[model samples]
Target: MLINLSGVDKDNYTLSILKSLEKHNSGSLKITVVMGKTAPHINSIRQFAKTAPFECQVLVNANNMAELMAQSDWAIGAAGSTSWERCCLGLPTLLLVIANNQRTIAEQLQQVGAAISLHVQEIDTPKFTECVAFFRQPENLAQMSEKVVRLCDALGAKRVAQHIEDLTKNEDFANIRRATLDDCRQVFEWRNHADIRQFMFNTDELIWENHAAWFAKQLGNPDFIMLIYQVNGVAQGYVSFTRQSENIWEWGFYLAPTCSRGQGSRMGRLALAWAFAELGAAKIIGQVLPHNIASLKLHEKLGFFRLPEKNDVAQFELSLDKCYIKKQFHSRFKIE
Candidate 1:
């Protein structure tokens, strides 16, 4: 594991982390800590590293920060601009909010599963130890890495440069189209994927026969609309709307299992816009399982208001006018 405390005056916090690590350390665990050149307690850290039970390295202003991060399984670091750098490298992190400004960034990242956030005061608690253990699990590490990489893929600057160059050109980054028979197999596979099925109302592994019959029937229904969200001609997500009444529809959506992160938010924006403009929907309703925290957060981000809960399920609704207002204010990314 990597612990980067460079540029932050958190030597005591670093030692606390090291103490926790000592208690959990086996011969197999290796730790690398990077510190600024002018760090006050560098000598103390170096002494601690020399006698650590497990392999530990203390480096001053390491020139190989990116290399170290890329090779590590997970990290514990301060929440700052470097958070994006870590995200770009797909590093699962336990973020410590060392400043008031960083608290929101840490919390937001945690909410999206991109990173785990903890107050600096919590470093000595059992929660810190639990977080350390959490990263020890391969599955948990992989999941967090996937989410983090989605937020930033080391292409932010390049994307910005390209956007500036193409400012005058009318280009569509995303679009939605009606799903057809050709999408049946792919859709079936995505629906049955464990990640997708977990949040679904029906979590049973679906049989191909039932799925095929249902897909065909839904395709034939006039009141049911299934659309595939595509980016540059590749399908990345699936969305469906079931008309409940005039101008009112109940909707569901999920991204492809292998789709990149942030695509869900883009897909949601495009799908909602299409429903309001093309389908003439005045209001859209969505039902989510209580445990589906990501979906609930997404709905809230899209300006959906929560209705009363029913049978332990949470429901949210967004009206056309409110969506229009949100789109107007958030016009940085055009949803054509």
Candidate 2:
């Protein structure tokens, strides 16, 4: 689902893309544009299309988004926030990376072979046509679609619940226990790092005093549960869960700034497994911005299913009773 956070400039790129689509005008290709939150840009697009084909349609709201994307072959979407929704649905895309904030995500998606990122300067009529034509090649489109299908097969919610199950199953992997108040000091360091903050919600660098206040407030919230991860008895990272309600949890985590040899996913899975099995919850949800490719992949790996989307952050869920563990338990031991 494309969340039009482009604000007033929403239709500029979509219109350009549609103009290119007209040039190709393949009867087989069906396209739909979903406009959200009163969709101011719809009128602008209407003005440009003199005659609308039966295949091209526009929709509003989250409910229609999944249906449209499911029915269509591919999506040409904004790069920043809407990207996750596309990934969550396993929809391959040709991205228009419209903002500076989106560069990291665009590069990551390209690295993983999930998307092609186009600059605004490179988004003219010819380039757009070429992208559409290139993907229309059945083999190329299938390969790209396969990547998305694998990455987003389950909507992302279920993966998280399964991860929690993993953690609970291997309780010994809870390497760090009895995290003290001082533990936030270490997490704060990573939170304030340049590379870490770049992908984060904040733009400016973090000040210790201000950062500490935020950390304390987050830690203090009864809804917020923080757990530190360690190896060889040293603090390496942390995992956090927000008890969203009796039935839901919002989760996030970060490893130490320098510790990037793929250990984060393992730790995440362990922590997630713990949450679902031990925390006594019906479902676990994760809200991720579109740009976090690693996190997106991790979510996919853990079986979190994405909801039909509406906003910048894609929503994924995992139901405990339906998770893989339950299925396995029922099969292996016939508990069910």
Candidate 3:
């Protein structure tokens, strides 16, 4: 866990967090705290670090917030710009609203189940400790992280770039990255969603045991690429490519149920571009349910041609040479 107190010189919130940690120490949770860049309360954090039994770090002007935050499973951060950064990484936070201006951001995130907002006036050991303890549950922890991604996608920057080639700057989407074991729980949530599962070739709610086993194999499989899409550093959707042959890949994707409509089209475009540009695929194919009209249209919009049904599945194919990516839909990578 990484606890960031932002730029506040002397915050009572840090003390509250430390006290909470002291009580939870026996549980074996390691913690690292960043006491503001120009913290005047450094003495307290440093002193606590020395006497604490659990692994604890007290950093000032802590190194790359993104990298540090990404490495952490949970954060107790001052509610501010870093809230968005947390959202991007899908790192659930117990946000301390230190300033009056921060309530709206904190509240909005809380409303979306992305975070828990606590007024600095109420900052104390007991309440903070309770929240941390609740998160210790595997189901609660996984759900909170999953909710964070729904509200802010870490891939927003790239998704926005896919629409505007000449734009110089934007924070609309987050960078897309390969999936790992840590993401299995979240992927399971997306996959098990009734809406998402219904359109699959096999429409069954996967049990955790089976899903975990399948997901583990996919992560290390060279023939499969599972990418998590983030908007503003929070995960919003999933895209994957499975190798069918030497020059062809089968692709599929789905947006979080809370995601907006037009974005699905954008994701398809981005995934297709990645298949051609990154993987150097000669062609890409999709298996669509005949009743799944939305996917059928999406494939056509992205230049996929209809083919005869294969084993009761509506088949679509896009040959690299004939693909016609939408004008507003651009690839994240440059087209040389």
Question: Could you tell me every candidate's TM-score relative to the true structure?
Answer: 0.48, 0.43, 0.47
lDDT minimum window of 10 residues, candidate 1 = 325-334
lDDT-better candidate, 1 vs 3: 1
Q: Ten-residue segment with the worst summed lDDT in candidate 2?
A: 327-336
Worst 10 residues of 3 by lDDT: 327-336
Error of 1 at 254 (Å): 0.5
Candidate number of the best lDDT: 1
User: What is the C-alpha local distance difference test score of each model?
Assistant: 0.87, 0.68, 0.79
Q: How far is candidate 3 from the true structure (C-alpha RMSD, Å)?
A: 20.8
TM-score of 3: 0.47
Compare candidates 2 and 3 on TM-score and give the better one. Answer: 3
lDDT of 3 by residue, 71-111 (tens): 88888887898898888888988888888899999999999
Instruction: Provide C-alpha RMSD values for all models, in order.
Output: 20.7, 20.8, 20.8
Tens digit of lDDT per residue, candidate 2, span 1-336? 222334345446767666666666655665566666566677766665446442566655557566666766677777787677777777778887788988888888878999887876676657766877787887887788778766655536788888878866754333534245788678778877876776676657778888678777776677777887776567777777888778688877777887747776666656666676567668888777788787778877777887876578777888887676434322232110
lDDT of 1 by residue, 84-108 (tens): 9999999999999888989988999
Deviation of model 3 at 99, angstroms: 61
Candidate 2, residue 86: how far the Cα is off, in Å = 2.1
Give candidate 3's error at residue 218 in angstroms: 1.3
